[model samples]
Target chain A: MIVSQKPIEIVNILTHSNRIKTFYLKLKDRIRVAPGQFMMVWIPDAEEIPISISYFNGSTMGLTIAAVGETTRQIHKLKIHDSLYVRGPYGNGFKIPRGINKIWIIGGGYGIAPLLLLAKKASSMNVKVISFLGARNKDELLFYDQFKLLGEVFASTDDGSEGFHGDVTTLVEKYLSVSKTDLMYACGPEDMIVKLIKLACNHNLNLQASLERLIKCGIGLCGSCCLDPLGLRVCRDGPVFPLKILVKLNELGCYYRSPSGVKVKLSD
Target chain B: MSINVSLGALSLRNPTILASGILGTTASSLIRVYKSGAGAVVSKSISINPNEGYKTPVLIDLGYGYINSMGLPNPGLDEMIVEFKVVKSKKVKLFGSIFASDIDEFKYLASKLTDYVDALELNLSCPTKMGVGLEIGKIPWMVEETTREVYKKSKVPVIVKLPPLVTLIDELTLAAEDGGASAVTLTNTAKAMKIDVFSKKPILQGVYGGLSGKALKPLSLACVFKAYEVLSIPIIGCGGIYSWEDAVEYILAGAKAIQIGSAIVSEGLGIFKKICIGIKKYLEENNIDKINDLVGLAHRR
Candidate 1:
């Protein structure tokens, strides 16, 4: 089997901010992928984790990763020429809205990685995209310049270092007061996505939001990433789901399982 | 009303085989599966040593199926065999699925497990590992060598759980048969991966893992259908046999028996009888005398 996995060379690395870095990766061949799709990266014996695509322009892909956990901490230690094993741009991706010329995008923290690509895809399709970007501080804000190239941006940093002086949700509340859009797409913290889902549901607007969960086999076999009560396995049925399906989930930010199968509170 | 069907050298009371990598790691779990109506239960793929496996997120419940990167977590074969011999009743037909890195390890495990279980399923198809599992099963020569070494030493029926990622599924089956394998578990999980866009991180700690569930049905059914066309030996159809119709589809496509893996978790333990009853109902409606007659019926056209 000329398997799905291969050792990819780190061709380039760009520091997006102090905490977040983007790696330019190239495998043996072009890994065709959709904007919201993701890759499973392996660092040999250390640990493997999934990373969403920030940019894929045929030849190479960019992963805007933050040094958040132990695996990502190790990932940040790599230099140019270091090899990283990768398989897939797996899981379902976002569905581009048809005939809609206007879209509103919302994201929090590192969740902006996948939305960056989606913004590019949407804008390139002649859609008027207005992105709402949020982070803890000015230094924490990511892809502001890259996003500026595609569409309009309303940014928020907690310290008021950028566009809006407060929370991203407040920015959305202000925007929704005056105008409405064809679709609202979001990716971010559970609380943020949960809030976005409620916002989208109340407006009766079409929404596609990505969700994250603990997953064992990235494929649909292990039950670790299953959402409670609704029982939706995040790996296959989604990394992305429509508002109608997502709104039905009872566990949408209320709880999640830990790495070893403990039910932990997801209030954060 | 005998539902027995010959799976190469072994004949199961019915065609419902509990696919490996479920709850078969423990003796009680194996007994539970048997009691629930599985014709046979395959153990979790055991190595010579215990594996802690990957951290949390070993399994995810997909609306239709599930994803797992469990890393073959199991107690060592020696320990598992001891528990089976001590606690598990010997009356239930048990198949041991063993994972080893090389030919010698495969041979040794097969030899040790021979008298304890009725059959040995060489787990050559686990998708998550590196040097072994699917890596070993991918090479036709390794498939032959491992099967030959284990077959020479094994007293019971030796079946190879072939990886679906292989270039030619039939080649692996033919090679195993050439190496004296009694049968081939037509396929195992597909190599797949996923990431959490929310965290901008991967879902599984191991990154890459296997894909099973309702999605795998067509691929596995095709494998059994193709293998049946080329082989004299019996085919054990696995991968996504969730319902009775799925099992019967495998039967019509040419599987002597079918193995259920993810469905055990998604549908529940009672799924075994559900499938059996559904199959029985089909047999009655069609006026089929033996369940074996349903096997490979699709080839008649």
Candidate 2:
């Protein structure tokens, strides 16, 4: 289908850190979105960035912003009630299994956003939730209370100022070790997912993962979001892929050059 | 309402084409483009044999452009014929773009796919590889000899895709016309690369990639304008055409049609229809009728 730009109104802006903010946008028309889907957010003349929908309630879309570059900083500068251009609900979302009794969800850094939304969705299905979220410090820790209200929440900060003295991945690993679950969902740094994927596979838990690639178009045109080995376009096949497929991604950690022919490792 | 931009005997319902690369990788993608409303779609440049192309991280995104060193990844002529046979949708015309390391490979693949496609695009100016670099295009005799060989054996109309380099472009176009080229598509992305300061390394595996998007529009326009001045054939201008204004620049500069690649990456597939609509609005506002009326209009000054 032709991608149409939709104008969404920002209902609220929750500042998560000095570098990151979360925008709760309510569209003029109802927006249909699934967990793990992303929207191309427009920033007038600067640039358009692909941001995963962190949380959405009815007509509202929540975007957790990390001001990693110029475009996102511009996005951060937006005020509540400001008009923002958006296109999509693009890419395949996390596949919700039927008859699940309990589910485990994990998030790290800004990746915690989408899984938080998924957790809220799972709650309505009557699935018991265990969430482990982590950031570098207490200030960078996001959405702790929102997730805590939904279910049992575990928060970790690297600087030892929070619940745990280590990383979120460690906390999720500990939870997974003790919990009986039907499925596991995770979003975070590649290393975290790699560790979680191995853990999920070892425990024989059903696992789904949301991977972030250098995205140019939210659609499949640019070929920038290709995962290694399978060469699957994240914009088309998925931003959320089953751990079964994600585990086989060979270029997941290989250092490579950007499109400008500059050499940079995929993970720094 | 529809507009037809003539490419020899073939007529495109709109001026927007998928351009080489992008979604032109396979017949299924080409079919998808036709379904998406592109008046025409050029197949990815194919070769006589299978090519694995550059390693992972072959494509990168610049703010207003893209650089890719895909190395003409293709499934060979034999595999491409199977793809050609399945294009049943008559509404969107198919154009097969082919490249080769040498003359024999070009002729062989051209003759093989000619019967299956309406037109053949000779890809002599890919920015990724130096083996098939500007050497052939920089010389008049090389262009004449290669085009002559392919044109002699192929039954379909031939379009010589040119690089953005100004040097010897007229000579190359003249040579292609001499060898019986039906039209020309100008211009391919210029070769470029990026570097990372922390890692101290080149960005692409090949150290160079084809640059496309708004960064190359002015250079591409110059190539089309120059080629149009010398060649009495249809010209398909492509390079950083992100808006209708860019497409109009191509037409007024002397392009009969235009192709879009990198913009689709940032804008999505809807860009084609959007550009066509914008072009229509501009034309209507300017009291222009057929798009042909504006071709070469810029040269008057």
Candidate 2 docks with a DockQ of: 0.08
Q: Lowest-scoring 10 consecutive residues by lDDT in candidate 1 chain B? A: B56-65
Candidate 1, B45-142: lDDT as tens digits:
87887765766445444455556678887667766776568434648789898998877788888888888989899998888765545577777888
Mind giving the per-residue lDDT tens digits that candidate 1 earns over A1-268? 1123356789999987777999998756756788788876666445667788888888788887889888788889989898776666777888886789899888888888899889988988999999999998776677888888888898998888888988887899789989998998888888888888888878778899899986555654444466644446677667898898898877777877654343457764
Docking quality band of candidate 1, CAPRI definitions: incorrect
The weakest ten consecutive residues by lDDT in model 2 chain B span B196-205
Write the residue-wise lDDT of candidate 2 on A14-133 in tens digits: 997898898988766666788888987764444556788888776777888899987777888889878666777788888778888888788888888888778888888888888888
Kindly list the per-residue Cα lDDT of model 2 for residues B1-301, writing each as its tens digit: 3457888877888999888877565455677677777888898788777665665345555666777777776667776677667764444588999888789888888888888888999888887875753357667788888899999988888988888887767887888889889888888889898764434566566789888888888899998889888989888999999888899999999998999988876676788888889988888888888899988899996
Error of 1 at A137 (Å): 1.7
Give the residue spans of candidate 1 off by over 4 A. A1-3, B1-52, B55-257, B261-301
